[model samples]
Target chain A: MLLKDTISAALEGLKRSRMRSMLTTLGIVIGVGSVVLMVSIGASFERFIVDQVESFSGDTFEIHAKGVQDIGKDVLSITFGDLEAIRGLTTVKNIAPAIFLTDRAKYGREEIAPMILGTTKEIFYNWSMKIDEGRLLSDEDDKGAKSVVVLGSQAAEDLFQNENPLGKRITIGARKFTVVGILETMGSPLTAELDSMVYVPFLVAKAIKGRTTYIDYIALQSINGDNELTRQDIVSLLRQRHNIDNPEDDIDKDDFYARSMEQAMEIIETVTMSITLFLGLIASISLLVGGVGIMNIMLVSVTERTKEIGLRKAVGARRRDILIQFLLEAIVLTLIGGIVGVIGAISFGYLISLIASKFLGDLTYALSVQAIILPLVTAVAIGLIFGIYPARKAAALQPIEAMGYE
Target chain B: MPENDAPLIETKNLQKSYFNEELETPVLFNIDLTIKKNEFVAIMGPSGSGKSTLMHILGFLDHHTGGEYLFQGQLAHEMDEDTLSRIRATRVSFVFQAFNLLPRASVEQNVMLPLIYHPTIPESERAERVAKAIETVGLTHRKNNLSNQLSGGEKQRTAIARALVTEPDIIFADEPTGNLDSVSGIQVMSALQELNEAGHTIILVTHEKSTAEHAERIIELFDGRITKDTTEFKTRKAKEEDSLQK
Candidate 1:
């Protein structure tokens, strides 16, 4: 009975001062909204990283020289013979050796300098590169060193705006080659940069370089099993083939190094996780400040309503009744703020997602269920935390003194 | 009626005091008093004479230190605050001097508040009782108005209706007309007189002679002790009864 009376009375009390109540509610709304938005943005960033990693299949590995700083820093590299040997191994399913070189690319009047990559057709499947129009290079093309090339998604756009580059001949580094295909847009800043490169047969690129036998990198995939063992077997076999006596000292002496796609995935997860934690810590402070505001106003309210407290007690309201009224009033106030904050957060997340997609190309603002719920829970807990002092003060007023108060 | 009906309220050598760290100040000295059921008793005193304190103790709104108070033949001085609260809830109600009606509450809400605490009365019956109380106070027309919006007389009437809504045994009004104009004061006193005529016990505390004159019996206090007790105003209720007998 007291709960019903007090709660209704509390609502009435708020209604009596609509402007003040609204102002108080605004504090919590901003606090909770920022927190939810921060959390959702964090989730979206994590999703963005995961999507980036997923584009390069999880079963693939990249082989390159250890501690190579630039294009020409490391002399130790992979040869075509070594690539054939790694393919012959039991654990190896597919291999593609590619050498990266930067040269002036030109088709008709358009000209720009971008990386020129030469590899077999296996790289198209290994890197999940989708061809826009025509077929990729065939095995016979790689063996015969055919002067046919595939354009990167960006390179095709820059070199051939509206015109079809497929079957059209273009000059790539003093050699004339027919464009066979163009890779679809990847949209990642890093992967998109890689997409700007032109792809050709391995022999064609080597012949252009005049007796270039060794390549800078080899990408490979393992048979359907644990890839860690496959990675280890590949490393030990390379050491044996290279005639390295001490394999443990390979970090300093060894010519080559290999990493699976899983290691890169782990790095992305850890970095994003820490970023979320740091941002979340900063956002929680606003909630604390909002709670403090509630506490401050409630204390003032208790003091101001001393006579009312006395009057209610004189007419038969118990301490618990007064306490429940003020406490529930505080809870109701924050709950209103919480609901408004959730809507504000979602709208903000959508707006932010739109803005981000403009520049980053399809980066989402993830508004997960957990992200929405945390701010609401924080709001209630804050109400409960900050509401106790004032309610208790109101409840403990003596009827005689309060009644006599002017 | 027999003359020997037990007193509805009996206080023997009732005393109240306030204490600081080093000294104790007594407010109400030794006093013995009895009020019967359906009595219209007014207590008058100068400032600091403890008339309001006595009324507060009698109305169960305050505690009287070092006293033996018998309320309806039950020893009440030793009762806990909760028990006192229960008595205040059902049997005793107060009307404060400042017209202490909740300013934010409408006249109807103010009147219904006391009944909200009455456990045995269902919620549905409270509205009817509140309406009746407002009618008795002649403020039924102002029931929807907030107390802050009402005139001084209307506010006091709403306070009285709040006192009356629970159907309490005793209505202890502490200077109900103190904050009102002479015209509003008279209207408020007559409302009390009307309630008294309906057989409800009315205990009033005031310093105004005209207000005290409305009661059947008046008691004057000097320095926390009763100096005079009189029945000078019996003619008003008695003459009305005599005319009714005609």
Candidate 2:
């Protein structure tokens, strides 16, 4: 028989049982939909986190002391002398020694817990922070260790409540500090809570901690993304200054780490990829069940159309022709399902992206072309594989025996 | 009728039996028959006389358990399923008692079914043959109507047209008018008779005496065996001999 004839006959058979065909297709739709949605959300999640980290800063490195809480740990702390030494390197654009102190601030009747960071004025160029009003801590404030603070936008609002905080003295742990500047608003990503911080000169913050010798870390910006070269220089200089014997050892072995923004981005990517792969496989199980569902329906179709099969055979349809006709029907059934599933998944992914972007800081969901193509191909394959037994059953029916069936 | 040319269909000691592991029920036993070219014969018997079974065996729709069956002297009993299907497609066609036109297909589509499997004709020629077949059956006005949408007579005629579309040499119509009213019955019988007069050999299986009377010859089956055979219409070979004498 001609391929066109087989297809038309299959179409007629399906049209006679529209409800059953649609129900069988629904299984594949759910299968493909969940897979696409999971992958799209995963890709969008990776993009969101990467974008979030990039928003923090760019082309920078940080030197931090190793954790002493763990066993066999060395308490290698960075010093201000090392920061000054690295600042003169040709690849270094700017450097700032940052120290954090837990402190409470008071303004008239209001009290707010604020994270206080101590750094130089060049810290503004290394981070996203900018002065909205008044002046940042000057070099004079750092040299003299003056009790002056720059309040983060949220912290300023909480302490002063719309009042101009510049030059207002706020007591922090028995020390009165004049607020010299209010930093611009910056919503945090997966990093530091910058909106609720207060900035001070490095010397002043260390003096408040009563540990003027040890600083938390020095933040360094590289000129034209010469970050790796700058990291090598800092490691050599720090190891020499602290007099660690092994120059061949890695920084982590010396209980120190020079971390970059790129490393954090890679960690986020690995995490999202693993999660999406796991979820996508779990979603494919439903398609397997859908294939069996198609087989069951096709078996019933063969039983119901036995008489028609008899008539076709009597009119000279070969067994192969009958098999091809029945097989084409099942394949056509699932192909329709596959197409509908891809459309549903893509549109659903778009909805998820819209909602996530609105509520979750620019998170997006997106369907990849593979997400659509793979499932559609799987649906076709499922039909081809599962359709065989029923098609063979129909083809093997004897014309006289089949005709005798009511 | 007897002729010097080879018979269209011949079966010697044809037998059919239904069997499983426990039992064997014989349906037709040692039936010997021959049908000549352009012969219109009806095999008539009461219910359960194995008339339909004999028709099935003769039509190549069933395999004979014991027989030497031949189609134009080709050994049909030795033919494989593929060869039998090829023969069925080109040399033989059937119009069942139930008017087995595909219920969903229109009259035109039902008529074109045999041609769908007709390999000898070019693809472009099939539609023209189908049109002529439907027009010959006087169903051109209702060609677009579905099979189930037609009356019983129309359905039977459509089946005839479907059988005629490939222009098979032989037509085996198993009770073609069995389900129709008397007027519709005569109409369907006349259609088969018209095809017979056009030099197409037709074999019919029926129990109705009035339906059997339309055939040029009758073969009576009783208890799975032929009891009598008679011819009412004058054999064409006899008329040709008379013409030659003139």
Worst 10 residues of 1 chain A by lDDT: A67-76
Q: Native-vs-model 2 lDDT?
A: 0.83
Cα lDDT tens digits, model 1, A1-406, are 4567778888987787778778888888988888888888888888888888888888888887765447744455666667777888898776888877778989899998988888888888778888888888879889999999988888998999999889999998888999988888777864887678889998887787666667788887888756788888887777777877764745456678776777677778888878886777788798888888888888877777788889888888877778888898788878888889889988988898889888887787787887888889989889888998999988888898876776
Residues B29-73, candidate 2: write the lDDT tens digits.
888889998899999999999999988888889888887887778
What are the lDDT scores of the predictions, listed in order? 0.83, 0.83
**How many angstroms is residue A233 displaced in model 1 relative to the true structure, after the best TM-score fit?**
5.3
Clashing pairs in 2: none
* Over 4 Å off, model 1: A63-72, A75-92, A188-190, A203-215, A225-263, B1-8, B21-23, B73-78, B229-236, B242-246
Q: What is the lDDT of candidate 1?
A: 0.83
Best by TM-score: 1
Q: What is the DockQ of candidate 2?
A: 0.60
| Candidate 2 residue runs with Cα over 4 Å from true position | A56-97, A120-148, A160-171, A178-184, A188-192, A212-259, B1-6, B77-81, B120-123, B227-246
Per-prediction fnat: 0.59, 0.61
